[model samples]
Target chain A: MIRVNNITKTFAEREIFSNVSFSIPDAKIYALVADNGVGKTTLLRTIANIYNADSGNVVSSAKVSYLPEERGLPLEQKVFDFLLFVAQLRGMRKKIAKTRITDLLKKYSLFEFADFYIGNLSKGMQQKIQFLSVIIDNPKVLILDEPFSGIDEKNKELFWEELLELKNNGASILISAHKTDDLTHFCDAFLLFDGKSIEMVDSLQLQVEQK
Target chain B: MINSIRIIWLVAKNEMKQMFRQRLFVFLLFILTICAISDPGKENLYFMFFVLNFSMALFRSIASEKESRLAEYYISIFSPTKLLLGKIKAYAIFFFVISLLINICAVAGLLRFVDVSFLPCVSMLCGWQVFVQLLGCVFYLSLVAFGASYSRVHTEMQGSIFVIAILMVSSYFVVENLADIFGNVLLCETLLKYIPFTMPFVKGVGILPMCVSFVAIIFILKFSGKIYKKRLFYYGKNKITEG
Candidate 1:
């Protein structure tokens, strides 16, 4: 489980969010919804420890996998090498990392381009690679920021399936996306960030309200 | 500890692979090696050039990571200390191997072309100079890396790189004319020899200054890590950590 307790973040005296508190239990997926600059990405980063919360803490019992919103993978690195490097940094042994990366690539139909430079791939292909890197180590908790930004409908379906698999495997996932309609279909609940605080609502409740 | 070492080694290996993949970088390394043997008398100038070039590399690496937001992702995986030390370790190995090769080639060129009789004296002097200069390279590189942490983009690194380049060049000139600059003050000369920037060039000093350089390197690297951690996620003057 991942628990964010009373987190606050401000930039240059401008308060983005304050005392934001929420939790994601095991084997569930939650969507973070907010308008642009409303601290959706910032909240995700704080949980991932990429950015420290101003007045609170995020507590996770195990390794947390994070996929930043942007295309931050090293362009010069080959896909396999980049994944291996990240896995090792996350404390995975080389043999296991290699095995898992291969399996993931094959599953994603990216094994043919395993040795290709990441910069050479199309935008959607690169997004797939980035997502593969995120799930390579079987993380216990995941914090993904706008992971569906640059992909097509078919790839989006693939991602949803993968996320469902991860959730069913007892992983806690917190994902932020602009499309609440897509998230309502599978996400267990929603954490709506409205600039000052967060309100947790059940996914069924969201669908009902939308109807 | 072993895990940390493994992580550092992985980072270093990755960096080495990335650098070697660049044909221009490889060509430059070749040119540098050739230059070392062709002009043994200008080894001091070569050392300065090496510092300048590698400092640029460090600046570019750090700046580009910040610009591309890759540093943010890296920070989440490992401590900034590990990332920075891994980077420093990669360049240290590169500098050590290349400089050792250059020293060997310069000595070989001297024996074959200049004078065989000068072997004993030249060997001892070159040996000590190489050791001292290696320490100097790490020291300066750490300083540059620390300064590079302040930059948010590649272009923003110009101010720090300029200042560091000037410091490195001035240190070279200062070492070249030590006697003229100090003018017979033994205590002053001894003190100057311990300053991390010039310590690499001042020979004949004992192990004490070497230890001092080690301390300086450790201190600089630790401070650099702290700065990097602070700057990595910072958006502006608000100081995100303090928000």
Candidate 2:
């Protein structure tokens, strides 16, 4: 479980959000819905500890894997090598990491592109590779920002399947998505961000309200 | 402790692979080899070339990582200190290998002029030269890492590289050529004596500059690690305010 206290963040005298607080329970997916510039990315970054909050703290004992909205992958790195590096950096042993990466690639049908440089892959393929890097180590807390932006519908279905499997196995997921319909069935709850703050709403309630 | 070392080793190995893949680096190595073999008499010029070549390599490696935002991934997994130390270790090894090769070329070139009887002394001198060069390269590369972290754009990063290179080269020239001018002034002479470049000329292996260089290396590494950590977390429009 992860608890975010009354976190406030501002950028260059502009307040992105204030007094935002929430908790992500284990074994469920929480969808973050907000319009552009509503601090969805910033909020996620704060939770991941990549960005510091001005006046709050995050409490979590679980190991975390964060996928930022902007991909920061090394373009020259081969897919297998890159995933191996990610796993190792996350504290996996080299032998285990190699096997885990190989299994992930095979499962995702990316085994063929293991030797190819990331820059040479298609956008969707690269997104899959990035996604694989995060999930390879089975992080306890998985935070994804716009995880489905570049992926195609077919891969999206596959991704949803994997995410559900992770959720079933008790991983806490916090994802930011603009498309509500796509995530209505997958998410257990929703955190709606206005220009000033965040509010939690049940996914079922959100669906009824949309109707 | 073991985990930290493993992290550093993995990062350093990957960085070395990336360095070897660059055509420009290969080309520069060729040029450095030629310069070392052809101009052994001008040891100062050769040393300057070594500094310039390694400085550029270090700067390019760091700047490219910054531009690509790739360091963010590593920063997310490990502490900024580990990341920076790993990079320093990688470049230190690179500098050591290249310095060794260049020293061999210089010794071979010098052999053509001197009698073979002086081979043992020449080898010892070459070893000392390589050690001093390694220390200088590590110090300069740490400075490069610090400077590169402040750059948010390619143009600014390029400008910083030139500034650092010029600063290093100019300081070496002033110290080597204008020693007499400084010698007359007590304060200037005192400051000049601490400069690491002048240490090589001092008889019996200048211990003072080596000590100064070692301290400077530690100071810069720690300072740069803090800056890098701050930059990684406090980016995107907000100036990092001191706590």
Candidate 3:
């Protein structure tokens, strides 16, 4: 379980969010919905420990994998090299990282481009690579920010399938996006951000509202 | 400690490979080779050439990461100390290689003009050249890294360049007229001794200055690491706390 207690954040004297408290239970998908510039990314980053909250604290007992909205990978590295490096950074052994990366590449049909530099790959392919890095280690807490931004329909399905599989395996998944419709089927609950704070809404109610 | 070393080594290797791939590095290196061959006997010119080239190299190595926002990813994974150490180690290796090549060329040129009997002196001179260049590289690189850490994309490159220029000019002026400025104050003399690359050439390189340079390098590295951590991890309108 992950508990966020009264987390507050501000940038340049402007408050992004304040007194934001929530809990993420195991084996559940929490959809974070907010408009652009409304602190969706900031909230995810805070939970991932990338950004520190001003007045609150977060407690978690699980391994975390965060995919930020911005893809800041080294473009000079080859696709395989980048994935392997990220795996190692996340504490995976060299032999395991290499084997898992190879399998991931083959599974995602990226095997042919393993040796190709990431800068040469398409935007969608790069996004997929980033997504793969997050799930490669089967982290207990998966925080994905705008995971479907540049992905195509087919790749989006692949991502959803993998996310659901991870969720079924008891991963606490917090995914944020502009469009909530795509996540209606997978998310267990919806956390609505109204610029100042967040409120939890039942997934059933969110589905009915969408209807 | 072992884990940190491994992380540093990995980061350094990757950084070195990425640096070597850049066309700018290759171009500058070729130009520096020509300059080294042409001005082998002119110590000041050679030193200036190294200062400028290595300063630019260190600046680009760091500033480019900030420009591309890649530092964010690495900072999230590794501690600031590890990241800084990795970069310093990588650049140290780079400086060592370049210095070795230039020393070889310079020594060859000297041998052509001088006699074979001065071989031992030539060897010692080459070794001293590596030490001086490495010390200079680390000092400038640390200063530039500290500067680059706090700056964003547009300003980081220019900021590092400005810092290197200012330090190079100010250190030269201060070292040249140390006695005139401070008038034999023991404390001032003691402090000046620790400034790397500031000592005058005597019969040979002084042991005291070499030890001082090593200590100075450590101090600069520690100071830079602190700055990097504060800049990278704790940047917001409010105080950031770790859980």
Candidate 2, DockQ to 2 decimals? 0.36
Q: Give each prediction's root-mean-square deviation over alpha carbons.
A: 2.8, 3.3, 4.6
Q: What lDDT tens digits, residue by residue, belong to model 1 across residues A1-211?
A: 9988998887768887889888899999999988898888877877887766778998897878888886577898899999999888888888999999998899888999999999999888889988887887888898888888867999999998998998999999999976588889889999887889788899999899999
Off by over 4 Å in 2: B41-43, B104-126, B178-180, B184-190, B196-208, B229-243
lDDT value for candidate 2? 0.78
Interface RMSD of 1: 2.6
- The residue-by-residue lDDT of candidate 3 on A117-208, one tens digit each, is 99999888888888898898888888888888878999999998999999889898988977678888889998989888788988899889
Query: Any idea how many clashes model 1 has?
Result: 0
The superposed Cα distance between candidate 2 and the true structure at residue B166, in angstroms, equals 1.2
Cα distance off (Å), candidate 2, residue B31: 2.8
Model 2, C-alpha of A178: deviation from truth (Å) = 2.0
For candidate 2, what is the DockQ-based docking class?
Answer: acceptable
DockQ of each: 0.49, 0.36, 0.26
- DockQ comparison, 1 vs 3, better candidate: 1
Please report, as a residue range, the 10-residue window in candidate 2 chain A with the lowest summed lDDT: A61-70
Writing each residue's lDDT as its tens digit, candidate 2 over B1-243 gives 998999989888887887778888878877876776666655556666766776677677766666566666566677666777787788788767867877788788778899999999998988887787677777777777777666655566678778877877776666556656555544554565577545432323456777898898788778887777666544343454533
* Global lDDT of model 3: 0.75
Q: How does candidate 3 fare on TM-score?
A: 0.81
How many residue pairs clash (N, CA or C atoms closer than 3 angstroms) in each of the candidate models, in the order given? 0, 0, 0
Superposition-based RMSD of candidate 2 using all C-alpha atoms, in angstroms: 3.3
Q: What TM-score would every model get versus the actual structure?
A: 0.92, 0.88, 0.81
